[model samples]
Target: MRADRLMTIMILLQNRGKMTAKELAEELEVSDRTILRDMDALSTAGIPVVSDRGKDGGWRLVDNFRSQLSGLTMDDLKSLFLFPSGKVLEDLGLHSGALDTRQKLLAAIPGTFRGEAEAIWERIHIDSSTWRASKENLDALKTVQQAVWESKKLTILYEQADGEQNERVVEPLGLVAKGDTWYLVAIRDSEFRNYRVSRIHKAIVENETFIRPANFILAGYWEQSKEEFIQRLPAYDVQVEIHPSVMKRLYFTSKFVQVIKKESSSPDQWIEATLRFNAEQEAVEYIVGFANKMKIIAPKDLKSKVVSLANSVIDFYNEL
Candidate 1:
């Protein structure tokens, strides 16, 4: 806990500059004395962390002091790496070699997180298929990511979803993945765009340079295209309560529900709550089949729809 607290303090200072004992104590849930002691430890470790006492300031970093800027830390990699799932992907297809992903990532992580990172790498398995990238695409994703970091321009062979291909010079944004796909999020000719990494034939960094816009955030680009997914479900939110016994199995499964506002939860230690069916007729039919354990809830119209559908099914079967 102390080590974690110490790491927390460093990160806090790294993000917020500095803070008084009162602030750190309250935020970290430790006493003032403890905060002071932790500060002493940080200083002894030569963290360049500075503290000041004044009416105008609680604490602040030394002026113009800067730590080296790097890529993702051990924690960052761990979060991105995704466990158990990593183990699965090792067999599927994931690549990050000439991507120079490791060195850059190592540089980003703080010296403190190095150990935890090593342990995680040893324990976690990211199953990925052997990258089948033609030298061109393999080169393109690598170039695009590098250029984004270096602030440069890129000429890449990109194929759109409609099967169109062209060599376009674009400024890079970032990379994102969904299910088995990876995309290069970028700006081409002043327009924002996303290029699936698989379709890129080749990428070359042009000698030219480009200014990264002051107002750009990657998160804005990567959210799932909900409109595309919602088309698969019924008009309303379907509701189905699952039995508890199946909860653990469901929890262990990785669901890529492409588009669904379904849920599966342990209402107690014994019952699972699941909802999946947009149309009442469909939801009811699904709920009834699992009648021994599942229940339908909400949307009064759905109940009626389900009864009618069930009766119709019964009638059709009886006629047969």
Candidate 2:
């Protein structure tokens, strides 16, 4: 990167008190003339660096010259370290600032709980693969989250997969972020609709805000939605001859009906597990994900559907 040497110089100066031109050149593997030129550029940029001539001479940024980023508590800094921002701030080719900001951030925090913080940092990693990217709509997201907190009306443009876009005034209800994807559960036309943040092209905060009803919550609505789905979809009881050795693990998941039982002592380590799904298609799709691990026993339709899906996937990949 064009500024690689310059950044190196800045970091070194930030860490070490001061250094002579020769030291900078040797540390950065560059000639004295190159270092001198960089120092000129750096000085011109008002980098709070001073050079002394006679004996006690070297270039140095005024000690603690950089202002602290204030108000962030130790916990806050640690949290940021544990979960760095998703976006790449600058292209490495352009700015190439190394010394991960996260490391510097952690270093600045008080050392009292640094050990605990380190443990937490190692254990807790945010996949945020589902969090909406870009600051493009952050103000809107914050406004909507606030509205959800306050039960206020929000105007937003929602885009469908088919490329259709519609602008509507709706009430913000709650939010859920799955992986990096964020969803806003809101009331539209007296009905709850899940709006994917990425699909929302625009949001306008209305003059009106609201106080959210104490009775409302997104999770409660979601649980109700699951129950409703079960009622809506055709109920189909399924018994699968799952591999016996996995019975304990299968029971732990409880992905199936509570009515689980082993059919017989099998020569092969396998067990018969009974589960139920609202829709045959759903069950079929579910089992297909674990193709070799599961075998549908009683319901021929589920097995056939799984097989059909597998065949279709195989055919598609084979053609590719």
Candidate 3:
């Protein structure tokens, strides 16, 4: 752990030029005394760590000193290329920036490791889009992105969960891309909110800009919001019995179905499992798609709704 902290300190000083003991402690989630101890250890290890006193005093690496990132192994190089979050940059229309940064990284690495890193890109690829994912209509994406980067306010036509459209003027904070979906984190009425980029029909950047709060970390805020959103979502547990033939399909294909406890001992028979869904309607719609291959064992209301839909489907087909 101390080794990792020392490496982190070096990297931080290398990149940031200088940072106080308090700042380093805060950044590393350690105490100022621990930071001072780490600094002493770094100096003892022949790493030139310059320190000074007073308000402008902090820790910094000696100028022109380079680390051994160039000596990374083939696996390490491959790990660097295997970034699923690169999709986020692509969604934000920063694909060129991502590519340019990769190229620069390749140049920085030693020639021996560079070939292996470049090969990783060719051997592995990440497909972040879901099955049958629809094209996102983001006409306002550029306008919203501009607002986020420039710290400008924006007036937007946003579609709500109930499909009602409302005009909102907001201070854009950050943009988060989860797979193909994009969400704009913003401030309005002194409250933070998330707006789906696809739901934004129109966006006009306002001339006025606001000061971004110093302590607001975008990544941290997004994580907290994600947890809160998940907790707030309406979730219902469903008991289902699946035929062995479709059992694997249910487990692999459905995000709604999380196997709680498998009740089947044999491989060829019906397997009882529990699933979850955001709403009864959603559960009904998804289960109805499987036709006769699946059955809802409990939650009689959901079973009834699925039965009603299946009968309707049969009636329409019989009429033809």
Which digits, one per residue and each the tens of the lDDT, describe model 1 over residues 1-113? 79878766655665566688898889888899998888788788876666666775665546533454466555576874444344223323455432234434433466566
Question: What are the per-residue Cα lDDT tens digits for candidate 3 across 1-320?
Answer: 89867877776675567899999999889999999999999999999998878889988877635554745777778778886755566666766621245654664565556567878878888777666664888788889999999999999999998999999999999988787788999999999999999999999999999999889999999999999988898877788887788765776675765566668658877778788887787788878877777778888777778889889999999999
Query: Which candidate wins on TM-score?
Result: 3
Deviation in angstroms for 219 in model 3? 1.5
lDDT of 2: 0.68
TM-score of 3: 0.67
The global C-alpha lDDT for each of the candidates, from Candidate 1 onward, is 0.62, 0.68, 0.81
Deviation from native of the Cα of residue 313 in model 2, angstroms: 13
Instruction: Encode model 2's per-residue lDDT on 200-297: one tens digit a residue.
Output: 77887777875565688678887787588667866677888776556565555535434535576665866676777666776777677666778888
The Cα error of candidate 3 at residue 27, in Å, is 42
Provide the TM-score for each candidate, comma-separated.
0.39, 0.44, 0.67
Task: Sort by lDDT, best first.
Answer: 3, 2, 1
Best by lDDT: 3
RMSD of each: 15.7, 9.9, 13.7
Candidate 2 residue 169 C-alpha distance from true site, Å: 0.8
- Model 3: lDDT equals 0.81
